[model samples]
Target: MIPNLDVDLLKTFLAIADTGNFTRAAEEVHKTQSAVSMQMKRLEELVGRPLFTRDGRQSRFTADGERLIEYARRIVNLNDEAVAAFTKPELTGTLRFGTPDDYADRFLPEILARFSRTHPLVTVNVDCAMSPVLYERSRHGELDLALVTACSEIIADEIVRTENLVWVTSQRHSAHMLDTLPVALSHTGCEWRALAVGALERQGRKYRIAYSSPNSNAVNAAVLAGLAVGAIPEICLRPGMRLLSEKDGFPKLSQFRIGIVHRPGRRSSAAEALSRHISESISNMPRQLMAAE
Candidate 1:
């Protein structure tokens, strides 16, 4: 007989995948580290495949482990949806939600769609702007919840994900080969812009800001048009774009953090429900992006 996958074990597995460490995953799932290890052992026994391989102190997912992530997420989400449908009261109200344009493009569709299916009466008012602007709006209580990129100027209530920032150029263009690199970036005060310029300067590579915009789409447009190289999170990478590496004389850029911040004081049921959906949606994002690549 085929063994049934355990929802509790899958939740633990997802916590490990999301945190990238068993110790941290244990903390996340509110279990002892030893118990987490035992759970994984049982999981591997059930699947009859090794899920993780250790590299010194680090734990990396085996191929089968990576493949299981998508399935696990779907199962867990469906389980939650079923439970909420019967156990929780339906939420209704308008929710003021804010996020940067890039995140809105990449994540909001799935998040909002899933949310609406569960809480059809909750209307979400979305505001797209730079992260800094969103942070301020959330702080002022003008927004019920905001997803903001972490930077020196703002604090996030919870960091949902983190990924490497990469330098990219149009696949058909030689923009990265230019002596004075033409670059497209976000406007002043943007953390990505600062990181990009700082990386170039640290490498003693001369570059000029050929395009600057507050909107991510504008920067992406310049990049896709082959007008300039752009620095963006790996998840934001689009087709027809090639990454510039150290071999291309580009310095490695730091990882950026994505976080959720809430307005101070009591939040509406709609806001709380939406926030849970956002977190779960983002938790599965990196695995989906990796699978696509």
Candidate 2:
């Protein structure tokens, strides 16, 4: 007979793989680094394959690890759906979740991994798009829950997370040129782009879109090259990047609301479970940022 695999252990493995850093992964799962390492050791022993390749300094997913993550996501999601459907929870159908593209690179993966832990049986379909598109989809029933950023006027049924908006620039650039140069932003429908543009207009400053990319990484690349100044989450601006202060002539942008909107009315158990996990994940890493300089 095949040995039984522990679902909780699998969840921990997935977190480690997603973050690629033991410390960060540990924080997500509420475990100590040493405790997480031990869990991985046990999981590898039980699976009978090496899941990760740890070079002296970095950890990488093995081919097996990659395959396992795919299966793990499905397993975790499906399990949650089962608990919701048959048991006291009762949420079996697929959960189509949407989020703004800005979160795609930074937070989505981690959030998904955490959500999967509870709803191991539900299928989670994720859509990353502009806030308007996501909101429209949720309204149309195409999405069960959506995490988006929007102006105060676009109120939602639920507000999930809120974050500080700050100006980001390359450390190599001087502060005086902030308002003079063009800025990098996303396509027009994006909430962040709108906020950035609104702030500039309110200050009576003249600027242009020096560059715009559909992908956040592309925009980050433009700013990294000293191409232009852009507004980004305060959490995302790390030690190696420059934050424009009041002295720099760039006014502090107001905090943006990152809300989680779900279909109005009562929610199914599976949906609630997924939402709870996401909230937990977000809460755990309240202001965690990347140092990708």
Candidate 3:
């Protein structure tokens, strides 16, 4: 029997719709790009209409795709609600969680909102800081849970995702075109800063640290203001920020890893549950947030 256009298909459709890229949508569902494409083909077959069309590499919704979005969202929401409604215990307790501020601002609300729907009574006290600091605090028991942007060298069983680092500049600024490139980045100990500077030096590219901030907003602000080129994850590049490539004379940077850290040994059920939810929720980020036009 043909599966009844189930919740999984709806979720996949939504991910593709939201991300506009097959690879990204696959990331959301922890599937391979080929699998996502195959599923999309199956969905189109089931609906008996073309749902998407590609313009170059970017996927745009066809009329039929647009029509399905509303229904898909409603069905997915109802499906989730039904599942949560039956889950026992109402999952209550405080989980002391920590994440970097920039990531929190971009991704936390949706994560927490959905988590709350399933575990309505759970209280999540979130601390926003540098990812390294979050890990340190988690190690010392200052936080029950932490999501860290761990440098690739630091392996952890809890690693959830790995993303590439990209060189970027403000679309309004030609800073990267200069003889000595100006850079805006986090203060010392930032993995991006270290990897970026190292890449430049290895390539014999001259650069100066024109702006430094412990806060991500400040670094992005400086870059946005055309003060300097910036190094950040590709997922953080939105319009107004130009992603640099070999054509732009910038060398590639290393990957950044995201992982969960929790207190060693025994942990509260609430904290464990919250940590799992957070890991799953990490990919629920808004599309076009870092996507360049």
Best by TM-score: 1
Selected candidate, larger lDDT, 1 vs 3: 1
Model 3: per-residue Cα lDDT over 18-118, one tens digit each = 77788899999999999998888888988889998989978789999988887787678668756865875677778888888767765688678877877
Instruction: Score every model by TM-score.
Output: 0.85, 0.63, 0.75
Query: Which candidate leads in lDDT?
Result: 1
Rank ordering of all candidates by lDDT, starting from the highest: 1, 3, 2
- Across residues 1-293, which tens digit of lDDT does each residue of candidate 1 receive? 99999999999999998888999999999999999999999999999999999899888999999998888988999898878877888988899999998888889888998898888888999999899999999999999999999977989998888878999999998999999999999999898999999989998998999999998989999999999999998888888889989998899999889999999999788888888899889966654464214
The TM-score ranking, best first, is 1, 3, 2
Candidate 2: segments with Cα more than 4 A from true spot: 1-92, 173-179, 238-240, 264-266, 288-293
Residue-by-residue lDDT tens digits, candidate 2, 189-246: 7677878899889888888898887677777777877888878887566444688778
Q: Considering only N, C-alpha and C atoms within 3 Å, which residue pairs clash in candidate 1?
A: none
lDDT-better candidate, 2 vs 3: 3
Backbone clash count for every predicted candidate, in the order shown: 0, 20, 1
User: After superposing candidate 3, which stretches have Cα over 4 Å from the reference?
Assistant: 1-4, 8-45, 50-78, 152-157, 284-293
> What 10-residue stretch in candidate 3 is worst by lDDT?
283-292
Provide the global lDDT of candidate 1 against the true structure. Answer: 0.90
TM-score of 1: 0.85
Give the distance in Å from residue 242's predicted Cα in candidate 3 to where it truly belongs.
1.3
Q: What lDDT, from 0 to 1, does candidate 2 have?
A: 0.74
Superior by TM-score: candidate 2 or candidate 3: 3
